[model samples]
Target: MGGGSFIEEVRMLGQGSTSSSWKWWAVIGGLVALPMCLCAFCMVSGLGVALLGTVGLMAGEVRPAREVAEQFLSALRDERWEDAYARCAPSFQGQLGGPEELARRHGGDRRPVEWSFSRWSVEVKNGVRQAHLEGTLTTASGEKYAFSIELRTRAVGSGEAWEIHAFTMD
Candidate 1:
């Protein structure tokens, strides 16, 4: 009877070992596959974001010059002096002194409230392409003024970017 019981125990141990081996294989497979799955998901997500960004850019006017002009006016309207200054050409920056001076000069009663471009023209001056935009703006006191803005292409970090070359309000 004791011998029979010992044999039965050995058979049970062999069955348990087979099942444990299957469990170990499942764990190893999952460990190997999880990182690959994660990498694939990340790659897909990154591509999707880039595609959406490209679509968003394509949906716009695609004119860097007009975009910069709009950005400059929007910055001024929002009283974001530094942002407006950043969109200016180096020569214009020299003329405006600095962001602090820009704020000091345009702040308060002189600040523009609302503005829009009515006409656009392009020309080449000194071998540099420039965009001219004519617009109208209303001051804080409700005085309407006509304005013109010039944007020129400038070398910026190995890429050409449009910068505000001149802005005149009449």
Candidate 2:
């Protein structure tokens, strides 16, 4: 009679029946599983978005050096010796005396000459910039010469300012 009274109390509380007990277990299981599923989904989606953003940024940032290289070649082609020399490193200018001296030493232009640039590439590393230029230089004597030149520059002070550090012909 005592155990029978406890069983009656459980039935009245709605936990003694099989269907009600199973319903409570299902609710607890769903509460535990939902958060884990949502967390895994967010992690996978965030990684995908980050990867795409990085690739886009890298492509957008690569054009500045190419533009600089083109401007440099154009100056040389137009026989703008002063402008071309201005693009050289200040240290080189001081060592060689001046741009005019540098031209006299390396310009190789006894008379009017024609020049064209080809096969150019520019690279930037650790705040230093380098450019490779390959082209043909035709003297007034009608002699066609092929040359490869490397130019190095560095960022000066703050902002986007750059200064040439060296120019070499090979």
Candidate 3:
């Protein structure tokens, strides 16, 4: 064969080898990259879902025990006996029967009273909540009584909505 023809043939073979190598490289790269991309996408989507769930829970379900307790105390302070009694946990209401019964049991006269919290703490266990409130209760007669009350609460439905379940004075 002529020298020029031989060189042309060699050049064509080199080109073909280069093209084949490039194709193989592209295939390997795609194989390695696909799963990595999928994993990254999954991780991002999982994080977004978790954040959304947390926000929904904070907005909907988890009622702070402190707020409920404060409202209950406010009702008592205003001498709204029935209102205050309504705020009590169902178990407590059942035990006391009614507002008049509760007042007699606690030695309260169904009159306005002042109360101050000395210490307070709240805890949640297995989705149930409990609050320990220690404070002084002052009657209209100027008598002050130190008491620690335990309040129990639980989430009622979807979201963080909560309702009092019980109350006990110790």
Candidate 4:
């Protein structure tokens, strides 16, 4: 039986059966590639949308979460409470305390005269954009505080809108 099976396989190969035809392979390849191509297309399109949403386009220009964090930090450092609060997500604005309370907490002795931001990194995780910035906060009296900050952002609308979720400092 073993010898007969090996001989039958060789005979089929020599006979050039339909299974070995180029047309058959092409049809099989096309069928397999159809779903594969569709899946790739879906992934690419989804990634593109996520990127756009994360970067946030305005007036045909990109405004990334890092810039948002930069602006917020600058406002806080300058004691511009209203401006800083304006950039915060509504949910965050009224969370632990009011904007005025935040201003008092950060604006008093904690406020730095100027900041030096370095090692800026931006990444997106599960549709949330996280901006990591590390640097020094210098006070008017020449006091420097090394600090690390993370600014989070998330898409809110149909892949076209975004908001600053929150931020943490260390």
Candidate 5:
């Protein structure tokens, strides 16, 4: 008689038959086990996380508005003008001229040495998500000043990404 269904063939594969069922079992088992093995390796060796970040699978680790703001400020603190500029929304980018402008403005004595966010408010309006942050920033001269920043979520890949929409410091 003809070979049974695929599942039945797999079930009979270990019965020591000389039939082609072992080939089917090998193919099916490989298909099933390969992904499981890859996932386990990724989880154990941390490669999956690095791959996810490199491939833009999840927009890095700054998904939330607060995180985006903190990252932006951290970049400014480090005088990484391009990194800080990259966090600005497109409209904001227009106002910034470029990363060079960012450096010209925030670099040297104007750079923030440290900062902290004291209050946050988030809301979604007309399909646009926005976060408002208020905090204090310390300058390189050891002067503390009040600052407020607004962030908005924009479409990125299949999800949303936070970007600095506007900011003010005194």
Candidate 6:
């Protein structure tokens, strides 16, 4: 009876079908394409989300100790006093005075003639992640000096993180 009922409906639909068949054709096309369209949508959205995740990981929102140390030096090399100072540890920030102090000392005539990372070391200290790096600094008057930075991880909601703790570069 079920098969017979379906056949009867199809036959009736065929009998009254319009000459142009545009309306029935649209309904039939939609019925055929709905599932395909939904599947494609899911695949595209999934790929888009995967791409975004990869980009986020590369950006290092949850950075490790060594990378943070490198970033700190890069900020100093660019004479971005506020950016470099802001990377300091919460406890260290108090001792470093403030951003204005950083700029006052490092900016203008006192800025390094040039600076670059010389070497790096990473280890766990009493369960805290740490990175030590030496940066080569040169002054405009042809004076060469060795500077160093130490960075350590601190709690952040995204998970493992690092910020500058202390340095001999000042």
Each prediction's number of clashing residue pairs: 0, 1, 5, 0, 0, 0
Better of 4 and 5 by lDDT: 5
- Candidate with top lDDT is 5
Per-model TM values vs. the true structure: 0.60, 0.44, 0.51, 0.51, 0.62, 0.54
lDDT string for model 5 (1-170, tens) is 26688767566665676677767868889999999999898787797667766657333322488888989999999988889999999899999899999888888887899898887777778999888889999989888899999999999899989999987888
Model 2 clash count equals: 1
Task: State the RMSD for candidate 1.
Answer: 12.4
By TM-score rank, best first, the candidates go 5, 1, 6, 3, 4, 2
User: Model 4 lDDT vs. the true structure?
Assistant: 0.67
Ten contiguous residues minimizing lDDT sum, candidate 1 = 7-16
Q: For candidate 6, give the lDDT of residue 167.
A: 77
Per-residue error at 149 for model 1, in Å? 0.7
How well is each residue in 31-131 modelled by candidate 6, as lDDT tens digits? 88998999999999999999999767644432466567667666766788788898999787888788877767656655666777767667777998777
Q: State candidate 6's TM-score.
A: 0.54
Better candidate number, 1 or 3, judged by TM-score: 1
Off by over 4 Å in 1: 1-62
Residue 76, model 6, lDDT: 63
lDDT for each of the candidates? Answer: 0.81, 0.60, 0.65, 0.67, 0.84, 0.72
Q: Which residue pairs come into collision in candidate 2? A: 89-164
lDDT of 2 by residue, 4-44 (tens): 67446545555656566655556567788899889988998
